[model samples]
Target: MRSSFARSGLLTAGLCAAVALSTPALAQDKIKVGLILTLSGPAAALGQQARAAFEMALKDLGGKLGGREVELVVADDELKPDVAVTKVKGLIDRDKVDVVVGPTFSNILGAIAKPVTDAKVFLISPNAGPSPLAGKGCSPFFFATSYQNDQVHQVSGKVAQSRGYKTLYLLAPNYQAGKDAIAGVKRDYKGQIVEESYVPLNTLDFQSELAKIAAAKPDAVFTFMPGGMGVNLIKQYKQAGLADRIPLLSSFTVDESTLPAQGDAALGMFAGSNWAPDLDNPQNKAFVAAYVAQQKAVPATYAFQAYDAALLLDGALKATGGKTDDKEALRAAFLKADFTSLRGAFKFSRNGFPVQDFYLTKVGKRPDGKLETQIVEKVFSDYVDSYLPECSIK
Candidate 1:
């Protein structure tokens, strides 16, 4: 007996083919794009924001790319790797999508990599940029719109070292991505690490960890916690009266998405990211204004990256004359990186990871006292991923 997922895939594939066949008169040539995101879990906000921005991008493109109509299909991975793999398979087999935009978490991306690559589907990640993919295991079809997992953290570490912090306490979830983040920190942070704590994923209570941090008495603290974990951690740190004493430095933790919920607790924290809401450029200014008009909230790194991915797709489609079936043409077009990115200067490394500036962002209160992220400094200028040399892609 076939598994339920297998049966569902067959049904969906048949249905999709039938729709295409039956509506031949209505079938204008189109580009089918599938987005797989964690849309129903603790990290749902990330996907929600990405979806919102991508929709705006579609609108900006007049709902068309390369003179072809767009067929957009979205799926919720529910933050489960198994679910993500099934969804990827369905998108390729059932939906006949031309491109797969995301599976936001690294684990899910890792799970679906082989299947998507095997299918020769272009998988452009807007958020997750795992180390393995950047190095020896690089896939020609895989491109990261976001920085590598370690690159942003590595910038934060370099900044910390420049600031002369002598000792640090590191906190992150116990996962491959989290471990990679810590390694990035250690690579650049010259200070001695007083303590390293790996919390279970989605563990809400940071009280135990906070107690340990306080006892360790490190000069500064670093973390890569994102989503709800950031809110809980920052709030608890403030409540424990350590907010002022030990500076909180992070990557992807204290952003516009997390700062509003954290309020003043997140204020003064430093974070490293490729784009900030207030980047000074016409493209960025336009994106920020449009995003604010749509989302009614300041855009975060996730939103910027997703919007950039849409633009990248548009450029590629234009170059390919909307011929998504010509995979080689699309791949070559994507490698050109011709779009105006939200980040001022953007390009991909030989490994397909991003080579771009990383900004040091600070959480601050607007004149109206609402929280926002400001670009405090540029932590890394046109930096390339360290894993590129390990990649054998010619």
Candidate 2:
């Protein structure tokens, strides 16, 4: 009888140990996230910041999600929607990723939103937030830490409108975001647009375009060209002396990453940026210090937003105990105001967009060894896009 009782106790111990072992393995398998970003091409420099933020987040969080170590798969979308779509499909069908992180461009965002959502996967857009996605057209599975495409430009337009800048010329790359930007500026600013030009993406030489702008003689020129194109345009604009005759106002296209390349040419130019390299807040300072320390590179708003998105996801994972496989649970956690990000604290609205800040920043050399985006004007402090009514989701 004593031997039998001892055997029974041993059996109970074995069963309990087996269950405990299985629990961790099961939790670890619950979350798998895939990253899609422009790791190359003209936007490659911008991608560097996003990549850095992601790596830091993983390291800081000990590679865990929801009490389980996250299984992360990263792919370079190369700024091509087709490439982005292929990578996303592979991640879902082959890798069985539970959630998809991003595709930076708004055009690319629009292309991939349906596929991931249709597959019952959440597509967390860290950067792209087009007006269409923010409006009655919004999707339940599509969430953005990034501000709406128009919100920043709307602020720019409002600034222009307030200043009574009547004669303006608009330039953008021939793409969805560019078109959306043009429309956004037009939405608020009632002014004489001398001409609207759509240049090819990544066109470095703008001598001819500058000549036309100089000839038209608009009071101001508003442009939407990101990455290399922004660098090239601003450089040539200075060379052509357009910066003296007409103040160049742009949005998102000329922040920290491109400003360094622009050098003295970017000085005194006004840009509508969500964050600057020299923001006074503790959150911005820490993020800038950490990024430069880790990657030996300055980060852009693109990187900042991406970093914010990861931090947001980390908070959600913890709230859900790493059980990201439950779509409803994960979504609820994301919606729950549990995140504390480098941008301070932010949360998604019912429609999956941010109530954030938009500032009109000026490019200038501060005392620091970096190009600074000084807040010359603020468009909105606690801003939510007016088009949130367009979102299909509650």
Candidate 3:
């Protein structure tokens, strides 16, 4: 009886030790991520596409990021800056997420960037690469999977200049990105600016802007309206009889996110982009196929960038051996960008924004009757953001 009791005591001790050891291992095998976006309002389509693409990427990776199971917490910023700050704080303080990914607009990014970085947590922007973040406001903890706010618009400006547009009319929302778009177009466009108009963000009624464009009668109209605003502006621009009279050159105004709504009105319209469905690369082909199959729609730059964000995190975590505790090691791993991007050639600039190709794309109807942005020509190859010189980091 005494021998049996001693053996039982030993077994209990071994079981307790095993449980204690396994607990920490299991805890370390999972990492939490917070996904915040403008999942509501007129721009909801953009956020929805991003959310779907990230989820699709997660699924493609067998629900693991760098061999660690991902615990994803999604929040809707409703395109409001204050709401974004509050939600991001909750992710940091309450959920203790290891990484934070996105609010889709520049204004929201401006609101939340300081808070997330101040906490020493990694923040990745799948969209909305505001100019300030790319310059003096750059942060070690902040990275953008998208181009700088001005890069695509710069592509538009170059295209306009090459096409010999001598006079151009510009319009954008009155916000940081809006201002950036105007600056980008003007950077390379050494021409007569007939007029520059700034409207409030999310202004669905463009009758006044359309009137202004008509009155200006520039050689071309370059505008940067996005989301539902894009839809309304394009439709109203066509309805107001300006579509044929003057060419419309834009960025983000007639994209995959808004194309469905813009429909035939946006057909043959040109925009600047970093990727298109017809971009011929194995990774891009596969991604486009999967996105169309699953989502029943063409993936926009927003979707591709968000998908890339997932790949970015996966690659960085793999380089860190799935460890999120070491900030410097993780940041270095991200700087390496050890994953094949959907954009064929992608790398990080000094400011942690993408250095990739830019394209002049045209909206065309696919054989299957689905509308998509198709690549017309590569505008800039391996383009680095112009703000690289301002970043303090090497």
Candidate 4:
């Protein structure tokens, strides 16, 4: 039931077709790394981009790492927690991969955590940093190369506090991620949460939700609806004529991938993220140029982070003289502060999360009719999660 790299979009046919065609000496073999993501249904586009960027990184790595072939196994978790567990199980039990990367959603990440740990394989999370793992829920085998979910929103909430918005309305999907986002916002902003509403995870129709937000009459509304849900919410927010009425503050709902699809509706929306295509860093400029040249498009934050993850992994492999199948050795190599990512200098927390900057972005349109995200403010510089004290790494 496990699909190979070709069908999974992590490798081309030439690679899979050649899997059996390798010389006998090739039996010295490659270390297999499995990637599980929600590659279909509502969040398909997010998973697709994550997988695409990841494969492109391997391709950029010339299909090999540490002198050994790198084989990627991808599974679709369909954005469901239960499905994620099943997919991880299949990858570990059937494919016996040495390392794992990605499931994208924080909820899904929580689902796959135990199985991957029980199997004794390292799980490298390029996205999805739930707060629990940063605290007492921390796992030795789990490493998040991306920021914790609270990092960006905590920044956004603090922005609200600085602006002195007294009354704020909050909305998010009734899921683990949504609750975490609300808690993150609350952690920083000491404002009147005039109202808070939890909508179903798949509620694409938001007129009802919009009404509650409107009636709350709050100075601002904070939300964390990523993927397709964002597209629907922005469109409805515009249609409801709420765009100019009440300020909209968000985390992960507006980005390169979502901006274009959102078009004029997203113009001037308040957002925050760790990386934007418009960041003024030299590494970001190079990453944006190279990414556009490769894909003929803007790279999403997820793509940039995943792209960085690959380079980080590459740095780890090379540091250890390209010998990485050894799990403990690989973990040590990975924990070393060794690489410059597209986000510039990168390092991990003692508990395996990012300590990085967060930016406040405004959704604006370029003169050429293409929508773009422009930085508007700063939340925190070189911020680490407050829950680090609860982690057991030290």
For TM-score, the strongest prediction is 3
- Tens digits of per-residue lDDT, candidate 1, 1-394, equal 9999999999999999988887953654777889988888678888888888888889999998776888999999988889898988999999988889986778888898889988999999989988999999998899989978998888779988999999999999988789889988988887899998999887778999899988999888999888888888889999999998889899878887787788878878888788787789999999988887777788888888999999999888889877777777888888888799988787877778878988888988766566778888887888888889999998
- Number of the predicted model whose lDDT against the real structure is largest: 3
TM-score on alpha carbons, each prediction: 0.92, 0.91, 0.96, 0.90
Rate residue 291 of model 1 by lDDT. Answer: 81
The true-versus-predicted C-alpha distance at residue 341 of model 1, in Å, is 0.5
Model 1 segments beyond 4 Å from truth? Answer: 1-28
lDDT of 2 by residue, 1-394 (tens): 5698899999999999999999967755646889888789887877777777877777777776556667778988878889888888999999988789887788788778888999988888878887777787677777888888887777677788889898889999998889888987888899998999999877888888999998999878999888899999998998898888898788866787788788888888888867777767787788788887887667778888888777778788788776666888888888884866665557778788888777888887756567756778667787877887766675
On the 0 to 100 scale, the lDDT of residue 384 in model 3 is 87
Clashing residue pairs in candidate 2 are: 66-321, 66-322, 135-390, 135-391, 136-390, 136-391
Candidates in order have lDDT scores of 0.86, 0.81, 0.93, 0.81
Off by over 4 Å in 3: 1-22
**How many clashing residue pairs are found in candidate 1?**
0
TM-score attained by model 1: 0.92
RMSD of each: 8.1, 3.6, 1.9, 8.7
Model 3, 209-250: lDDT tens per residue? 888888888899999998999999999999999999999989
Show the lowest summed lDDT stretch of 10 residues, model 1.
22-31
Candidate 4 structure quality by residue, lDDT tens digits, 39-78: 8886676777778788888887898765568888889998
